[model samples]
Target chain A: MTQSPSAAMESLSVALGERTYPIHIGAGLLDDPGCLLPYLAGRQVMIVTNATVAPHYLDRLRHTLSGADLEVCEVILPDGEATKTLASVERIWDALLAAGFNRRCTLVALGGGVIGDMAGYAAASYQRGVAFIQVPTTLLAQVDSSVGGKTGVNHPRGKNMIGAFWQPRAVLIDTQTLATLPERELSAGLAEVIKYGLIWDAAFLDWLEREMPALRALDAAAIRHAIRRSCEIKAEIVAEDETEQGVRALLNLGHTFGHAIEAHQGYGNWLHGEAVGAGMAMAAALSAERGWLTGAEVERIGAVLAAAGLPRVAPAAMGVDDFLERMRLDKKNLDSRLRLILLEALGRAAIHDDTDPAMLERLIERFPRA
Target chain B: MTQSPSAAMESLSVALGERTYPIHIGAGLLDDPGCLLPYLAGRQVMIVTNATVAPHYLDRLRHTLSGADLEVCEVILPDGEATKTLASVERIWDALLAAGFNRRCTLVALGGGVIGDMAGYAAASYQRGVAFIQVPTTLLAQVDSSVGGKTGVNHPRGKNMIGAFWQPRAVLIDTQTLATLPERELSAGLAEVIKYGLIWDAAFLDWLEREMPALRALDAAAIRHAIRRSCEIKAEIVAEDETEQGVRALLNLGHTFGHAIEAHQGYGNWLHGEAVGAGMAMAAALSAERGWLTGAEVERIGAVLAAAGLPRVAPAAMGVDDFLERMRLDKKNLDSRLRLILLEALGRAAIHDDTDPAMLERLIERFPRA
Candidate 1:
């Protein structure tokens, strides 16, 4: 809940009582052994990353871990959302088994959401469960996926159709990593940053509107503040509902439509945050239709998304039926009813399962396409 | 903890606070809707069984589940431990998704240990976890695997190498199902029954020694008592330590050696309980060698296993190196040291990681061959 006084790092705890872990955010945090070593469950550490990320940060991480009496090993996997499958996770398990890594061993996820999700799952199911650390190199992962314990691989039927809520021992977010992140990817990450504002804090939305250029420029201070705020909001939501029984559903304000978009386009075609950007715009529009928000409020939401360089319209190739078919299969749905997270206000979200089918159809039918 | 006064069934709870659920043991629990309906998370129910089990009990289970506003579906997998793989679980997930089942759905594992383990893992990861009910039909499942919530599948590298400690909503054990169990399978279940006595209760051991013939004969009252006591012991240990952090390791008294045998013999070749039976014998003999158990005490353990029709000797083809290699990869081992659950005295077990390799090697070398 407080910043680590010794360094420029800010630390927050996802308070799960016994499983409570720290999220450390700062530049050069990955270069500091102090941030990584203490959380290692044992001397056996398995670093799971992708070929793309491995070339950039794996050696630096290995160098930082050199002085310890640790038995460090790594499994570099192919890069892409398509690679986020059980087969890739099996490679991780194979590596752990080949290395004779035991229950006491810790798995370090050293890439983006795909690597973190797959690696975390590998930790969750390997020998039942083991300790894991998230070293998210991408901004999307740093502020979102890496902080929460939602770990899994894609099922052919759905995204994250199979996974476990297995938390990491620590999450180390190196803000410096964003320097190497593609501009489009940076814009994608900002989609989630904008989401935190739209769902939980209008004041943060105001700040983002004013600081959009600074954020887009990769301003050090602006990025740290954004990452810290996003993680704090996510941690608060997750802490209240670790298994998503209640309020956690509100965090998925755009995920239902977003997941449908991802599935329709085939995952990786549109980055997750990119789809979420458009999905959130759809949700805002729907919320306005439901009289929860004004037309002006929906326009304001669109402005922030545009400022962040995120898509503000649905893909032209997708149809209303495509949206309906995919959204119906969302994990959030219950008892055959479609559960949607709608904007109750600029900074607040609500779960609604009673949305009339005809109204939803009209909304999608009239909605603008890319 | 008490038997149901209204019916001929006995009931016990695995007290995990808010996650607590009951285990009902009786002659025909599968025919009683009351035993199951209350725990269904929602109207959606997916019965996961095997070809061997569906013909005998599927209709009966459906009949019991009928007359309610339930959307019931079933996935019948092929029989055998070989079917206990991620592919089987994927089929279960695919069915749930195809049925459009949601977070509130409950999975019913309606077969033996394999079904229970795979289905439980399915429930654990399906939509990040849903409620599941275990209706274990086999004796091995009813007495051991069903109650503990140790759900998983065997990895190509090892037995139960991938899994979770996801507790079930309830466990229903109908002793009548055992009537159809093969003689060898019945004997396999008895191995676990004898294990509880050896690890926790001398009196239960004495009673089992006297009641072996009656149990083998499937005498209704004798079978019920064994299942109940076994459930009770397992429940107590699980409540004390839900995960294998401490005291719970004792429940795996013979599992380390047993898993080695299971892995070496290729899972289904030597039934789980049969391997555990012989493993328990090896443990007793090793305990005697360590002066923690007397020769007569070891002999008594072997006699009880023999009476249960379980193997008392290691497989003839397995040498010392085979056992060592497999045992070293066991999940229970920590820090590159072999952690074994050994008998300190009859009815009491202890975790030991300091066993001399030469000593263990000699014990395995001298162990009697089948």
Candidate 2:
């Protein structure tokens, strides 16, 4: 938090075998064409964004890409999670084909996680795959979805129920975009930032505890440290396991329950990071009950999430039975057994599949809206 | 043709480094559940078939898969090249979600090329991909589409214009399924069988010339030989180039013109093989005009395709301009320059981007429908 915001750009690489890509993080990175031009293998590029994002940044992106050789197009989608559907993806497909985009074309996803997932999946499946780059705008996207190459859309039954593991050519995260982020979203994104500290770096948790005010106030130095460090932790885990065959599942700390909440609340009602914030609280409560974490450790984790203005309880209308039914549909479940990532301690997390249902029911009851 | 059909099944492996898979060709393979059970990594299996192929084999496949441990379901699509569309794929997505299919569910494609492509694409995108096995029932699929992991749906603008290069766990080709293939389809399948010979194997071309009668009659031994040899040739090329960067493009010898014909004729009017058959003739004519193949050699190749009842000329309604427009839309194109696969000589093919347009126009005019 002591350094200036524009000190120097940091680059991290996800070490997937052939699909390895770099994540570039800094302030005002988007102002430089050098950051984008090298990734374009061809002259045709399509920028995909949403109504909320296009007016703010699409013109600048177009200006940066205004070379005579480059033919750039944009497809603006409606903002929100509800818009991440097969029908919306089909619009992208039709737009690309109608514009005569082929395998040589590259799609640029320039918005939040929904746009990245939708555009990435479109790029993955378009003509058996084309090249794509990610310019993730939201904090949640910059640190999480944009890096791992997990691209997909939600099904009525579940979130991210249809997708492909297609990696982007590169992920360019310009932290300056956070200036335009809404307050609710800023706090929502902080939930994931807190998650990195909780799940992998206990020492970082202490840093966040001390600098909670700086982070909540959107101090550029504090934001940069949080994003770069969060990305580094994620990169190491992804390098170890790209496709979630093993250790990668640890990244889903609150996601299984988070996805259930998002789906139950009708997608756009609650932001993804918000649900995850609340869901992480429930997991912490459950972890304490399982004897993996002390009651004091759980409270410490809760205090940090609360400090970031995240929800401290689950929705009162959602009962344990609803979560149980929804969780059964989780992609991580093996056969019919539910698997969850829970805190083993303040900074360590482990995937557990043997939690007693009765105990889970009691844990849910504890998180009343009041 | 000398060996007994049931003596033993032949297995060929596609050497794609980490994505390598086995192609198993045998008589009565679907009759034995053992051939399929090992490939099922999970208990849930969804058989994607077509109306034409289901009545003949669905019950037998179900009976064979009648273990209490396995949960089997079917999504039967209308049987035709026209059925390969984004709309059809949506039906598959909805069906899988409704049935509670997740990442572990294995999709078995149980019909012809259309079903295999549609179902394979479904498996590729369903929850970011799941394990899928190919049980190709058509000779075209058994030898070509099923062996290579190219799965997709046709866009209204082009054939296979939307897809992903997702590999299957294994491919099972049952020679007995050819017994139910219509005469026209059996002849159409021979077009691709002839392609392997024309593009790579001169001696196999000679063998196909000798066995043309037996193959047309659906003789079991001849069918088995043709499928095995075709699969072998395809496996070798695919092993060399899985994603068609260089050597794999050689496999699309007649496909550029063929795809144009398929697209121009509205996808189902002429079978894929029939269009390819005619397209190959056009390619041979173009190759000879370019002084690559002898005029006599061109006629020899034409006579073999003619022997299989393949059309000798492009449809009269399609003018040279129509062929040019459609071929420009081929996946092989780089930017807007057209690249095509042409014969250097019998059993040897090369990708050519410098074909003289005037010469191509003259060649098209030679193929009058009358």
Candidate 3:
């Protein structure tokens, strides 16, 4: 299902009125600053990137953005999931304020999920929300975080503990940035890639299985197709349920359980996608135990995750009680009730609120150890 | 223009889908939590108020919201613009986290513009944006801050330095909250009420002049009508340019200059509305000097503000240089170029770029006071 280059890929728009943005997914799209320029609509531009990506592409992005009547203020931050806290968000806000950024100015977030989320959040909160463009450097962000319009800083209590659902005016995903992304980072991005298959697209799951090696090799066509499909599924879900009221909650397929694992180990202990990969496997197994998913289907989900170099087991000493307690704090939880999103079959999912706590405890006990 | 009590007033809805809320304004509506109940969706509630209002009406608000199964956790903060800082926002976040607030929970803000901004920011950032209701207690908040989709926490460097445009689920103007409000606070609110008239509605300005006495008397009918008109004017501007793109920028009216006065005096020296009252007089004088507004109009606007018990002059001995420096840090400034909203006529405003610094100096000199 991989599309050839110049295969007529188009852009999708997020409709938030004046804050609306187009998410472009295709080869060489990152090099396309013209697509992002129109959104600025003003003279000044300040880009917030990270240490890892700045060395590789900041100059290119700067050169592209440097035009008549524009002054670019770039702030390079340390790269990692642990960096998405108030300090980084505040630092960026400081830079913008120090640079005398005003209401009409734009803040460009040019990095991975953490970078984009923190930068977008800083922009969202700076002066009661400024215009920010998402220049997602990591595939994880290009597909999931960048397009969703969820921006925030993590609190001591939890990840993304503070933020706003501020939509971006434009998203630039340059495949060129992936050339510098480490293999481990690519694998982390794949967890979300595989998640699309595990939740609502069996055919895409089959395609990922067939294309795993080429994707592993970082084939441009394979990566492009994966990004587009993942974004399309996410965008559709967002359009239908922008606020996660109903169908959007289903999008958190393994997220509710996955969040607990991340919180238990601490935010940066387990990379987000790695944990999701393992959580999805656990969810699949739970579905199989409930007779909602076939054993064969569950095995197939594990196979793709394994092939993509993701974990299929939980932490060795993490207790079921601690996991349940953390899930209570998850954004998906309603009135402190643990709402679990379980797959009934490939390409189909359901939110199961009627699960017995004892039954969940028994199944959690059987989850494979590290 | 004052509407009678028991007169039907429409509930204005902000069109942000799930983020939408009805702005309930009328006599005795503050006691009616019914407009908020639907949006509460039966979720647990946390009442975030300030010291000034708590002793006055926390009991009434609690009784009104004391439906079965609605757990109320009240966090009372100090009253003043000084309390709108991150220190206060963090206190609120800490309180919410300690109380175990999840996404399903709602934050009810019951105070002046300061409390509304700080608590609304906590909601916007708390768990990446939760539902919040605004029960504006001060006249300034009722006529201005409560309507627009603006929320933020202050920084040591500036007012509303860190924040977002997270609109409330519902804005309850209990008209009754104003009864206990200090005369200073009421006069401060009148500054913004006058601002509405100066910016986009000359008729509103004329009406404010006519109703100044009743408003000063705290007539429930006068208060409700004034609040509703202000909301409608703000909502209309917000709709056309929600993020202050163009016409929305016009809504800044006296705010650009007023924010400077607040910061120059170190945030709390002058109540927000009083500075705005004085700032509006300055803006009108500037407009008149530029021939955009007639001298008669400027005099009329001044008389109204004076009648409202607002200052029409700047703090004496304040340097023009410090004033310009403070304005440079304002959200309205673009790369140090002050983007000011000036009057063309009553209710008609325009954004003026390339403002003469000399003119600002002279205006400050003429308005300097004790």
Candidate 4:
């Protein structure tokens, strides 16, 4: 990101074959949604938001979209990961339909991961795939969830267990939303920021290591660069493998292991990004054990995540063996064959097939002590 | 159709780019599940059916799929358009997750329109688009619902208001299932069968007008041919326009008026095909009123549906003005713009856009005394 990596700006594309969409990263994006007005159907617009971020910037978004032949319908759901369920989706769907939304209606989701995930799924299933504009209101959503078209409700059995790969028409990330997010939430969001650096951009990791203090302070420029770089990396991967057939799986670097921690602890108990933070540590540990990474690379991963206030060590109560068992249910498994995404150093992540269950068990044994 | 007009089997392709699927039509084809086995993931199978269809042919299907890792989870939802709701979908989602189904699972919908619609939607949203096999057991589903990939539950405000364009991995129609269908249900199914002929396949409508008596007596060969021909025609139209862009709306020849009747009557009061039967008569009346058709064309539509034991007329209690208001909330409406599929003559339908609302009201008057 030296020299701003093209101050001209970078745009990424999520290739879903016919449902493909673009992710624009830059300043002043929220001020202009004109680039996405083509997909906006009808004159009526409904922006579904949450409790936390509504006070800060809902008015700004309202003003931006005021030009469209649309009536804004805003229904603020409780703000949290726990709110991503079928119940929340029902409210959004009912409000839209009861308010006289037709097929040509567009729903704009504004907020963090939960809001984006829930709102995107609502749009996907609402009347069977209405147009949804992503107004992702958190670093977690903008850098990660908002870019991918994987929209759905979390099942009791697991997170994102029930969802569709429905692409959003557009995603608007106002960096200003970060000012209101708590430091803890912001730290959790950074785990994803660090994920892009670790999985596919070693240089980005180095940059993160250098800018850790500034990012920790919620420096706007540093945060914006991290999101832009993370999105560019993610969009490239998604476009190559939209349905998670190949490169897409690589995007799940620490996710398979991370999903385990999140589910075992109960979803909200372990913030997805925090769990991913810890899982990346476990993955680095396992990768080192497999000779996929050296001591220095593993340590660098730990250092970066910890510097961002993300959890680098496993939670004290997480039993290693229990963690391994939980991971078996991850969708990344093939015929119940556990597939783990391993880092081949800083700049690359490869999906390792036929992972040694015994090694996974060995890694689990070191859990509490980890 | 009487003379086997299917040159090269009348094939049409649904162009979804990569996720594209094929729709096949023929008689007594349900006995062959070989074409379906490739799309089935894992041996654990859940065949969702209704009580009505279970006693008819459930054993044969169970025996066929029993060869694989087919652990059948059969759910019997009540039969009727009224049964398509969220409660039923929840029942399905719970059953799938409770059974420890991961992404590697298959749901086979083996019943009529209600079962197919619900089961396909269950597959669509369950884990965000799982592979589903559609085995439509009724004429209405075989001809219409089973194709087009429209799967959804009805909302209190409207019918077929909640659904997705979640295409099935494969659709299987066992023409033999219609043998056990009640006379009224069979006649209702004919409303859709007659629909394909009136909208796009004019020659087929001519054939149905001739085959009405044989179909009324439940002639298996004629029933099978009608089902195949109607499906073939629908598949072609749907393949050309999967999402009702322009040509696809023509497929809803009677639905604009028909859906309103179903909603006003509180659904299930009149069978889907019955409402469609009367709705088609209303569409013809509208066409005549709009001067697009002559009295003879409207009379022919009324006579054909009436001879088939379809209502061929609307109920008088719900006045024309009230019916038009109900049509305003139609899912097909793009904003306040009305979309109606009308027949220029038997076997020739076109979407009439920007039609005068006052003219549509007068046409509804004829249905009261059809």
lDDT tens string, model 1, A91-167?
A: 99889998988999999999999999999999999988999999999999998999879999998889998899999
lDDT of 4 by residue, B239-288 (tens): 78777777888777788777888888888998888888888888888778
Q: Which ten residues in a row have the lowest lDDT in candidate 4 chain B?
A: B3-12
Q: Which candidate should be chosen as best, given DockQ against the real structure?
A: 1
- Runs in model 1 with CA error above 4 Å? A1-6, B1-6
Among all windows of 10 consecutive residues in model 2 chain A, the one with the lowest summed lDDT is A1-10
lDDT by residue (A145-228, candidate 3, tens digit) is 898788887777877778777788888777767888888778889989888887778899889999999988989888888988
- All candidates: CA RMSD (Å): 2.4, 2.3, 3.6, 3.6
Candidate 1 TM-score to native: 0.98
For residues B198-303, write the lDDT of model 3, one tens digit per residue. Answer: 8878888888888999989988678778988888888877767666657888777777678888888878788988888888888889898888878778888879
How far residue A277's Cα lies from its native spot in candidate 2, in Å, is 0.5
Model 3 chain B is weakest, by summed lDDT over 10 consecutive residues, at B2-11
* Alpha-carbon shift of residue A21 in model 4 (angstroms): 3.0
- Comparing candidate 1 with candidate 3, which one achieves the higher DockQ? 1
Candidate order by lDDT, decreasing, is 1, 2, 3, 4
- Of the candidates numbered 3 and 4, which has the greater TM-score value? 4
Q: What TM-score does structure 4 among the candidates reach?
A: 0.94
Q: Per-residue CA lDDT of candidate 2, range A1-370, in tens?
A: 5554334688889888888888888998776687788888688899999999998999989998996488899899999999999888988998998888868999999999999999999999988989999999999998898988899998888889889989999999898899999988888888898899989999999999888899888798999899999999999998898888888898888888888888888998889888998889889989989988888888888898889888867876887778888988899996777899999987799999999988887887767563
* Candidate 1 C-alpha lDDT tens digits along B25-139: 9988888899889999999999999999999999999999998999999999999999999889989999998888888999999999999999999999887889999999999
Sorted by TM-score (best first), the order is 1, 2, 4, 3
In order of appearance, the predictions have TM-scores of 0.98, 0.97, 0.92, 0.94
